[model samples]
Target chain A: MVLILKKQVLRRLITIRSFSYDKWYKVESERQKRINKKAQDFVKDKSVFDLFKFVTKEGVSEFKKFVQEFKETDNKNYKPYLEHGDFDYLYKFNTKEDIENWLVSSDSGYKIGKTKASLNLTQQNTGLFSGYLSSDYDKPEKSKAIYTGYANISSLTEQKSFKRENRINIDQFNCFMLKIRGDGRTYMMVLNTPSKYTLTYTYMHMFPLYTRGGPYWQYVKIPFSKFFHASHGRISDKQYRFEGLDVKSIGITCMDGVEGPFSLEIDHIGVLKDNESTEHFAYETYKIPKYISNT
Target chain B: MARRLLTLNLQLTSLNALACRRLLSSASNDDKSLKKVEKTEEKILQKYLRKIRPKDEEEKEEEERKGPFKNYFEDEERNKSAIVFYEEYFDKNTKQKDRDNFMSALEAFRVTNPTKNLYLDFIYGALLKMKEYNAHTHLEAYRKLMEIFPIGPIKCLTKWQRDNMHFPRHQNCAIQILEQMERNGVILDEDFVRLTIKIFGDWTHVVRKAKRQLYWLPKFKNSNPYPIPSIEKLENMKDIEIAFAALERMCMSADNATRIEAYFTDDLEEKTKDNFESTWIVTAQSQKQAELLKDHKKSIPIFVEGPFITWIRSKMVEYFVMKTDPDPEIIEKIKQNENYDDLDQNFKNLHNMFNDPFRDEFSKNKKSDLSVHELTDGTIFALCCTGTGTKTSLFYWTKILEKQISELKDFIIVYKIKPKPSFLVDLDKLKNDFKENQQKSN
Candidate 1:
């Protein structure tokens, strides 16, 4: 069925007149987004519908309102906090250290971990199945959903020089693919005194569908390695006292490692899972009135 | 009254939001066997993911799990749990027939059910690019669509009425809908007029939102009416405005964002090639664009889309001129014909006409009971007067005309009702004459 569609569209393209190119291009590109990618991949293989297989650094072919990135000024309480104002800061990150210092902070007794009030046990509300995401859990299986829990540093409002990011920790299980959105380096609209941004993607774990990164509203998927590297903790130890870098606090940060109101909209956040296991939905996936997907 | 699409047969399953929750988070299991990359260091991670997939789904249903910490979508399963809730709602709550009906009805695009309808009252705008009475089908589609969106129709009607000071009559469906909402008292005076316009053609809106929405439509997994442009008729006429009414309707909308796309130059299927910025109106319904085009600098026309610009650059007008006039002199006539100074004026008239709050010129020229309908027709006519790659200005059929003119006796003076791109202008002749006059100085 899909093959017939491919033939029909290509045939039309062959004969389309000179100017309709834009409109045709619109439909065609959108069409390609819809069926073309899958069909082409299918040609590469018989039945390749796996989401990861389709993640050609090219993202999934679906649109959601959440994909939109907005300036922090527009609506303060909007979902999906900004990693930094305008997606540009990350392009300037000169080294891993620069990003690390900016991403992780020490808040006296409040590192970037589960609040002292809440134990790592995940207050009943923060369980993996139905938890609110314990701050203590950087693990995907126990997430505060980066908006609530991610690289946090101190004194973002006032900065003397600059700060580097602590590496992210893309654990082995995380299927995040590190996909770049713009000319590989996204341009930031807002000004960063330091003038740089370092961005790493979490790949094929069906991100973009989840994290919705940055202010420009582009898809970002990172490899587990990049994810971990971008989110990893700093190591500080001497014979006297060794401490694994745990985020006690973070303020507004940009990729340039600036202060205050850093924002990032992760397009999707999931480590790639290699599976097409036909597990029946706990509730049968069925159609609804006029709209919606079946589980 | 005459519907373009069939009535939507809204079939809803019991809204066991609870049962739906069970299905929502737990649908997919973490299958380790399927993902045997055989690499080890990562195996530990997969093992962890497997343990949490379903457990997370179950947890999402508990009232405590969702609201507070839902923002942290760190992994696929929980991320899937929250984001995929809508899909889950449909899967568990709906029936197989309803799914098929939803899929099939998308073709008809008419709202069938009053409740549980998925895409109700959602503002829908299409640059029909198709002329003739049949264009009214879009109206019916617009009307029905207004009926279904979560809060769209009622909001549209009330907002329309308040904006119009009464129920909108003789206007595009959007205005009419706004008026209807007012009469129905389904919405408030402060309801966002812009949003209502996006759904219908209020003076402030254009269907650009719909265009952007459709632009991103392909990104969804298993979207209903997957493989958009499902029907063959929609295939070629994707963005072609069949008539002035097409654009007029969208222009009449209250929302500034009316999605307008330029038809590509017929051959480019590549994204990089399609990146012409002069085209594609990112700034929808902004007065700035209309103002910019009037400047002597000949600022890029905001309405002109990238593909259209490419079309102009493609020497398509040259192609048409060659075809429409085989005589060198005749081709010269079309080429020599300039619409700039006066053309700019004409463009102004059309712009003012299009920008007119009442769309009076459109109302005057079009054959319609609704002023909205008439105004929409006028806007489309203006576009047709320019170029749209079809029988309009780009002259897709002009190649055939060229063949005919070669055979016809008096083909030198073929006049195009619309202006086309000009290449090899007679301005060269003026340059030559200027040189001759300069020789006298020598």
Candidate 2:
């Protein structure tokens, strides 16, 4: 009797679940149809005149209000710590020894046994930082071996010179544009930010170089907003904004797990003001939507 | 209406703020002086707004139906008005943006009204003007004009020559247009060829100009024999047939070769010779001999002659066999076969030869050294039928045969096949012969 009663309850629960699922399916289909109709209507009504008409009086007022709110929130919440008037050359690698004074080598082989990496400054055709990395997966414990070669800007030696009178103020500048050439490989641009605690984290932005037309020099701009907070090479949940952080050092790391020779040529690194720079955001994740829907 | 007024007020305030920022940034000073300057700027902006308010009111009162030019680009009748505006003032417009807009509008109109030849003359005139202007946008304008109204090569060449003669500063533009037309599959005519020879016949001048204008000719993989064939070299040819063959040998595509041949043939009163069989045989023989002497160190004297079609087929078969690293024993067996007529049987035998495990091992070992595609009997037979092989395979087997004969100290004798007499005779002759025979019987 108890088993039959339980069977009857199970049948009732199954019927209820199926009924709810059918209702949800009907709602989803209807929503999809509505969205399709909206898309068709949008395409049909599209014209150059409609674009002009969108820049109406109400649109202008709304834009002004948004800008006003943004400015107010920015001023109240986050104040920049460093302020520098002029954008001057903080580090220039014109001489051969400047490389040693500015950069320190770090490789994954230091921690792992089977990986190999090397970094050298060669002046054959042009002065360039050549890095080679090879990985061996035959290591006993590890399932996969990742070889990384990095040249980090030394904070201990360069911090005094950088902070003396030529500190980079993130509020005034739009981006740090680096003139570099690379064999088509993805590399990471790392920035170490000052923290109140002894243990500080680094902000990283990974970008790929496309020199398909041949290895030619190109300027890669890294905007302040593109950097994401990461502790010990792993991303953290707490996000770091560029408004109030003091940047201690900058570095380049090659860690795409592609075990082969890699080289990057750096010509000049300089900060450009917001008005002087053409590109505002280095990465698309920080891109602002150009259009806003009225409805 | 209230919302519109509020929007206008906000826009004015933002504009005032921007202007104040620019002024302050340019002349930043003490706070008190800055305040004084800001107040003066605000007063000036209000006065300016008041002055423009009367004009805005007048414009509102007029309430004229704004033409396409009023919005510049955004209007329902933009296409029509833009066409009219371009037709009227295209020559006078000096701005690059205006020219770009005119070309874009013209393209849009052309797409909508493809059959309308009414505006072609105006577009051509504008194209001429743009060529004279010689700006970076001229190429785009020329491309659009050509796409809309595809002129014949003769007329295009004439126009190019005239343009170059008139404005020597931008002669490269004319060459660029011609190159683009050629890329777009425009067949060159006799007049066009004559004009090109007349203009670019001076090899020295063409080479000098080519240094600056790299797009004048298509780039080839290796060193080109005649990058731009001079008229003197082409004039020595017997006919368009030889000229075309020469061009083809110089790595020109069949399409380009035929196009050039047609151009030269059009000017001649006599028709081009359709029967190039004898000439082709001679040319092929000489070419094969020259290639053998240049490439191979061993002196190999080759003699290749047959009916033109048969000769080409045999050459293809030879190339297909040579490309594969076939077994020497199998090749000897096939060559010594008595039945030359049974080609399909011979091919099957060749296919069966590869089934041996030793041959497979040989192929496997050679696969590492040979980067070319692995040879299969099916592919070889297909290549034989198609008469198409890699460029290096041209007459490859003929050279191999010559090398073998030279090494063996053997001479190959080939006999020409003679044509048989006709079987049909005249009916009148037959009747006369019958009458004569009857007389003889009497």
Candidate 1 lDDT, tens digit per residue, A230-290? 1222111110110112222222222211111122322111223212322322112223333
Model 1 vs truth, CA RMSD: 32.8
- Residue B409 Cα positional deviation in candidate 2, in Å, after optimal superposition: 39
DockQ for each numbered candidate:
0.01, 0.01
User: Over the stretch A1-295, how does candidate 2's per-residue lDDT look in tens digits?
Assistant: 9857865885588578664333343466679999999888887787645666666754576577667666787554553332221232445565666565565455543554333333345442223554444443223332233223343334233322112322334555655666665544446766666565665544443323222111224556555655655667654434545552366666666654444445566655666444443443422233222331110
For model 1, the docking class works out as: incorrect
Candidate 1 segments exceeding 4 Å error = A1-97, A104-295, B1-101, B104-442
TM-score of 2: 0.26
Candidate achieving the largest TM-score: 2
TM-score of model 1 (CA atoms) = 0.18
Candidate 1 residue-wise lDDT, B1-442, digit = tens: 3342332221122224433553444334224322432355388889988866765646646423333333333334443434343333333444553323333333443434445433311221111111111232233333343434334443334444434433232124344344333222122222243445544444322232232233232433232210122222342452333222233332333224434433333432333653322211111122322222222122211122112111110011111111110224333333232111123434222111112224334323332222111110011111222343333333323222233233322322233433432221244587899999999999
Q: Which structure among the candidates has the greatest lDDT?
A: 2
